[model samples]
Target: MSSRLALPPWLRVAAAMFAVGWGANQFAAMLLVYRDEDGFSSEAVTGLFGAYALGLIPALLVFGPISDRVGRRRVMRPVLVLSIAATVVLVVGGHSLAVLLVGRLMAGVASGAAFAPGSAWIKELSADRPGGTGARRAALALSAGFGSGPLVAGAVAQWLPAPTLLPYVPHLVLMALVVPIAWHAPEPAAPAADTSRHGHEVWRVLRGRPFVLGILLTAPWVFGAASTSFATIPTFVDVDVAPVAVTGALCGLTLWTGAFVQPFGKRLGDARLIIAAGLLAATCGLLLGVVVARTDLAWLLPLVAVLLGTAYGLVLVGGLTAIELMAHRDDLATLNAVFYSLTYIGFAAPLLSTLALRAVSPTALMAIGAAVALLTIPAALASRVSPRR
Candidate 1:
């Protein structure tokens, strides 16, 4: 039966990435459920969302190196269980912000462990394929999980008993199916970095102009643009009818749009160009967000979502593709880790913007985000990214 259950190597690793991705977002739309029940402020709810980053960043910093040393399967198999446990924590969190915060933190840890290593694992497993296939597969799987998680969670939370608890059940069941297959997935060789040849390679790459200007400059907007599209933009509109489900749909719209855009981005051929185009799109989208926020327009939310989602999808794959060109085999996971950590910085955008609402208008804040995105374009273009073949 175990033999019968084994999935194709790359597919299984992709599945693990997907499952963790699903776990990472299952609670996103549930913010509405909590806020509605407890009368929590938007600030409090977004803070709960940001708590995931506190755990994720440290785990991301640690796990990539750990996986490079230990082999992908060793790290990934266990973390899937960790993800399940995190979901269990959320399942019973009910109305307690403290309990929900802990659950989110745990989910972040589980996600940070999987993301870089899983990206590297799937890339390694797809060595025989075209260069962009690995990155596209990774992006597609993660985005699919990201989009669907909220959609399902939102739907169940909107209509079901125990909204928070039941919303998490799908991910738990998903992991039970995924973990075994991932456990049996073939292991890639442990990527051992010899210090003599590549002394402190991650730092060395970090210092390179391309890495700094190309990736770091461009990465933050990846999620900055994304989080604002679904989380912040929707807050500007009042959805009295099935608001939670509507929030879920916004997440799905944003992420699924991004997932579908990867292939077109890949075809654009030059990773740097894609990154630049992405930043430009984000800038435009942010500017549009300013309009949406001021006009109190609900119909335009989908437009902003589509535009920002395009930015997220493009930069994400472009960054990964750029890393593929930049990093050595041994440092792939480490660089991936760095890239992901930077991307999560943007995840804080909604929270920051929510807090900023105290000092400035939402229109002004979104315009500021647009300005930042516009400034990033030159940095991305000036980046000495080796053109993807």
Candidate 2:
């Protein structure tokens, strides 16, 4: 008999819920515009984005492994409740920077809550299936959710009659739909027989060298790509074009290229090779951005967009693959949390880089940004290190 079962209705529901919850990050991008239009300084804009990550730290540290011990479904329902409240806060209190920060923080906590359990849930759902099926599903779900978030937010902002209000209105609708499904999602397995206290699970996992290296390697790849997609290019688009369309296009293209191109990039087979391809793609894209800055070439925008988007997509897929191959199963969620924590820290650099652009040109920023993306190559290498027999 086949060890596999159907995709399982509950898993599908959970994946969808995870995607919707994760989508909040895309909406936070809108805060960048709100900050500038409201005449807030760069530091203020940085604070706005930073709240999302701050919310994640505690959740990732506390909630992630707890779900591993408790059932994932149990943890998800409350997160949705929190997400709905955050969306409501954004809709009502968007004018104030402090309110925006709180909203972003709540959104981040939702994301942190969703990621590990969602990933693990997808894996468990596919455990009886053929080779690596769960990973693929998880990857597709994450990419789709992530890619859709910005598109949804951006499209509403661009075409809707009421830009600000419409963007999150759909999110409220999604929240309503997801919460019930989450409540009903099936748990395939009982908690592990060894239901020990999770008190020091984080430190236990962090002590592993491979886990630590994987976390460090992840920073450059995740942060570099995230910073570009979320902060740097958004700043550029806001400067050079109609704020809504340009921001929408940049994020939409970045996400679409990254996701849609994964099938082709995956054919390369070796995870390391895929990571290399992503690094090279981002390097070339960054270089193109620098040249466009130098030549003042408006036409080159599309080319740079495709390059970075594909690069980011490849890096994301590659990072997950590498981490899975490198870490022990028990360490998986903890290691991922550590990696993401560092990755969020790296996310902050672009905002700071944006501030630096006050003294320097965008060309200079592109040069520095591109260089930062390239540094991931070495981190990727380090993560791939194999112990000698």
Candidate 3:
């Protein structure tokens, strides 16, 4: 398969993107394992979940401009190596919290470093493809990787032996295969004419109102709501009805829905409206979650997943569109880094929700989430109506 597609640079980059995303989320389903076998507190598990973002944010910030200057492959190669190292850490030392933290952190760094440049690479490689199609493909690859990671890990952990160790083996093998492909693929030339200093240009793009408002009002919730659905909801589901496999399936469903619906979001054209509608859908989903928890109707979990997933798709694509429209060509990677750095904050959703749960019932906590989503709607609408700069 590799031989036949040796010249397809986008394929190699897409595969590596998928692997990075998969590695990032592989630990999601294992949060339960940590709670059950290791007796880690919910807070500890959520912190582990957030650790990825902690490492990811810095890497995104640092790597974006570096890739812009040095070209994508140079940045991607080392990050791919870091990705393999992360998996090895998980395979060998997953039992220890400290080790798990290191692994998650490395996974974050890998993701942060690779995602923007890899995405930009895919876009450049697919320049001959129809408008926006490259972006969709990149998003789909990452989403598939993100959604499938936990599902595979959960199923293996539930039915197969060596739950922790085995789940990572496949990813390690995948990384090994893709690393050579990434190295062999052609590197696109960096922009030749930019005279602006990196930090100044990055800051200039970031200070634009459209980009700032779009990211501030919508980007965080895209993953924040997703983390709640994937990381927190599964743990809350009735174990009898929603075992490890079921939980994993739910997480996958949420992500897959998000992935599939993104193209439609691009077609919607109005970023503000898309953001508003997404927040509304997410609000409904969270409110439904409150009902499901109170009524103990686990069957409705799928409905909640759909709503939240749709919201994720709409908000994500919408925000990306806005950023892409706002950014200068040379500064795209840096802009992506800034945008994604804010988005990664959503990884803390599980931890924040768990913390909220201590002071209020699940129902109340979800209600709070719903209200927050509601509040964002007006801001999104306002942003949409605001004159373009």
What does candidate 3 score in Cα RMSD to the true structure?
2.3
Candidate 1 vs candidate 2: the lDDT winner is 1
What TM-score would candidate 3 get against the native? Answer: 0.93
TM-score ranking, best first: 1, 3, 2
lDDT of model 3, residue 195: 50
RMSD (Cα, Å) of model 2:
4.2
TM-scores of all candidate predictions against the true structure:
0.96, 0.85, 0.93
For model 2, residues 158-194, the per-residue Cα lDDT tens digits are: 6666665677887777766556555566667554534
Candidate 3 local lDDT, 1-389, one digit each (tens): 55836557788888889889888988887887787778899899889989999999999989987887888888998888899999899888767999989999999999999888877778778778865556667777788888888888888877888776887777888777777766766776655837556557657656756655667767898788788787766555676843767767777888888898888876666878777778998999999988887888878888888889888877876776666556555777777787778878888998988887788888888898999999888777766323223
Q: All predictions: root-mean-square deviation over Cα?
A: 1.8, 4.2, 2.3
Where does model 1 exceed 4 Å of error? 1-6, 190-192, 387-389
Q: Give the best candidate by lDDT.
A: 1
Candidate 1 residue 281 Cα shift, in angstroms, is: 1.7
lDDT scores of the candidates, listed in order: 0.86, 0.64, 0.80
Residue 165 lDDT in candidate 2 = 63
